[model samples]
Target: MKHLSPKQKASIALAALRGEKISKLSSDYQVHPNQIGKWKKLAEEELAVLFTDKRKKENHSQERIIDELYQTIGRREVEISWLKKNSSLSYPERLTLANKEHPDISTLRQAELLDISRSSIYYQPTVNPGDIQIMNSIDKIFTQCPFYGHRRIKPELKEEYGINIGKKRIISLMKEMGLNAIYPRPKLNLSSSDKQHKKFPYLLKGLPIIRPNQVWGTDITYIKLKKYFAYLVAILDWYSRYVVAWKLSPTLENIFCIQALEQALKINKTEVHNSDQGAQYTSLNYINILEESEIRISMDGRGRCMDNIFTERLWRTVKYENIYLNEYADIGEAGQGLSEYFKFYNEKRRHQSLDYKTPAQIYFAKY
Candidate 1:
């Protein structure tokens, strides 16, 4: 007999079901009546299964489409991560992609995965440059004495800078700039009030950092731009004084802190990650990242113990050498300027502490 497609066989089966004579149909199609009878009976027996199989095929197709979508998502994530590490894309641009809404992952977590900061995610170039001169004066004061709160800053602004800004305005601007007049003393302390959460004690008081990734320190500081101001968060390898990752944001949010952390972890997860008890470090999102990685969490006491001293020293270096010298025009210019600065800092600028060796040299060679 001739080969018949399922459709043709189904047509014949339907004909027989409609009371067509089995012998007549077989004779017309040039097939035996017995084969015709079997086809008809089999089709009748599994008619329901045919409908079921169509549904199954549709389900299979849907699953295939979903799989393709997942693969596409995965590819995009990889591309974004690569761009974050390798591209000329600014810090804020990298943060923008990584800091997005996700169902399972928090935006902060996404920022970390992309290796960008959360604060940078929403940074706008629009400058409200309240008082550029005043803010710069404030920057110098805060840089000199970070322990001075707004109340103390107001007096210095009047006495030293000859600006009589109110304390409230100073408070507001300091808050806007993410600069808190850290009480007690500056340069190695912050407060976290989580009594239930396990807080590690200050681990780098007098201990000598022997290698890269032995203890990683992170901190946030304000950056003075030409018109507007921005905040900078950086992670440093304490031993080598290497800036592992750094980001600048218009505000002081923890996501950028998380982003810096994420970038550093990508290179090498450190044994201990140290920071002040600022909201960012104390945040559940940030804590979880370190906790999950099995990294020891070290927090400076509220008093004076020099928790992240290496990172504090870096801020002085960055400001004195690069940030102050350039006076970046805007966030875009600032981003570009800082990028070049960090590159030079890591690759070119030799440190007196490291015997005139660059951070990259000590971080890569001896370790």
Candidate 2:
């Protein structure tokens, strides 16, 4: 039999799916008609598995049976080995016996059967020397000077530690680390220049927010981890500082932000929902969701810090109290920390603006 690379197999499969004649496809693709015919036959056989639900049903049953069998064997083998010998079996001998009983089983499958992650099988201490040093410095500086921007931080690094670096590089690293200055008010970051999307004005400037649903604020913030970063979007009750909904994503894509808004709307529809003029918030898809919920749309004025003060404060509290205090090694850790902090912030932490009451207390106490 002639061997074909994956690329050749893919082309043949695609041509077969398109219903191209074998002779013409072979001529165009520069392969023999016999080879094309064999490829088409293989594709037709596999294509049924792709579209048909039978394979999935059979696989499900097979998985359950395999799991039960493996568990039963594992439990019995330990007792059998103890009873058969006064001394324990060697490592290789134990492995050999296990493999003989389950010829098709894999280590990964065994781990899954035991309800453990593959990473737990081979544990290693993780220590990134460079990232640890950078993270330590960032935590110290962020704690000491919460209001210092990247421009100020760059100069401080040079003067204090003699580590000369430019503002752009420092800013990029800060963004990656999810560190930003806690301005007295919100400073719009990375506002969109796309003219295709219509921009809304800051509607709550003079409007009095007396009730819980009168005005809602939304914003996206960066969540940093040792390995990667995630974006968080939250809908907040502007009047009460109560969080309605929130979501985290591995990218700055608009889908997660939209999902958070959708979840918030499901709970209760607000009269107005406000956000900064970032592309994710300003995209037609995002605005349509709010408009469809019959909620009026409002946006922050460009470069104005006071436009979204409530949400800005939320970000400040999250960074200072939770994120900066711990080293999040991954998204899961960051998410867990945020979950705990938001609960405390909404249910326990007293705010001076709310007359020394928590957000949830103020939001519900009024209504």
Candidate 3:
């Protein structure tokens, strides 16, 4: 009784499945016909499972990564919540806790994770009480009308709130507050003209988005908190206007943007992904994720906000509906509030553009 190798057994089994006569396989392999038949039956029983096992492995890996991320998020949330709860400690005091020599996280990330701006870490200028009032007014105005720039806001400030503030002051304050007007700017591509970051052209032009996963538009917007602001990045399905995934970060770092994209991929992949020419969207790591997913990359042209219009609309909706109304006390509050708001936005809020159907309804209609 000569022992057969696994490779030889597989070869014999393949031949059997290919319709070769069992007697011929047994003769070619110099094995008993019954042994050949057993191998063929085993292969037949396990062949389908081979492919299934591969998929299960991939899914398990993905699930493990997602679980790790959730754990990190939960731990980070606890730390941030503790910091926020201690109102006696100023942001400057919190900034001092960032260790420069930290191995895992950088100082910049530490500042962001602590919900303090990097610039504020170095220079904690005493802000005037009046300036805060003016900034709050500006936030309100910007939330309602994102297209309003300093020039437009100056007049609105005088007219709406009757706050007679100088244009230079408004400009400086808006810059410090990171409240840039959302409008088209010509030659914006030249800003990203550096060799490192490459920009893609708008691919959604004249293309109809007819299904849930046909196109996904993503963008980052500022969410106003009581003391500071956080950035919100979201990926939305263009056809159903469903928010696939969203992340709130205290900083404008590309990591949050990449996280949102990765989370959305875990839900479902899109044929084409559209985004603005912001550094977050054009960053190498962010672009690599989309490219690895085989998604067609589409970028807004020269500060054309309308190219990723659906995401822009999503920001406006989120702000007006949930953000401005509450004016979240801190990042901890903002995160919890946004979690609920997004659930409502997806599951309850009806959109007229969707023929008065909720985003969840339209998104899951095919399923």
Best by TM-score: 1
What range of 10 consecutive residues in model 1 has the weakest lDDT sum? 185-194
| lDDT tens digits by residue: candidate 3, 93-165 | 4545656666555554565465444443454335576877788788788767877888899989999999998
User: What would the per-residue lDDT of candidate 1 be over residues 121-208, giving only the tens digit for each residue?
Assistant: 5556565656777878887887767667777889899999789977777866665555655446432212433555556677767777
- lDDT string for model 2 (1-367, tens) is 3355786577666776788655434423445667777777887887787667876777768878799899979966764554355224321122223331345454434432332222333433253555445544654565466567877777777777667767776766665544556553333244443567899888887898888888998877666566544567788998889998887655554656765776787878899888777777886667766776788988877655358778867876777788778878765566667777889989999999988988999778842
Candidate 3 global CA lDDT score: 0.72
Please rank every candidate by lDDT, starting with the best: 3, 1, 2
lDDT, residue 314, candidate 1: 86
lDDT (Cα, 0-100) at 151 in candidate 3? 81
Q: How close is candidate 2 to the true structure, as a TM-score?
A: 0.58
Candidate 2: Cα lDDT at 148: 77
In model 3, which regions exceed 4 Å deviation? 1-132, 176-183, 186-195
Estimate TM-scores for all models. 0.66, 0.58, 0.63
Which runs of model 2 end up more than 4 angstroms from their true locations? 1-150, 159-162, 174-189
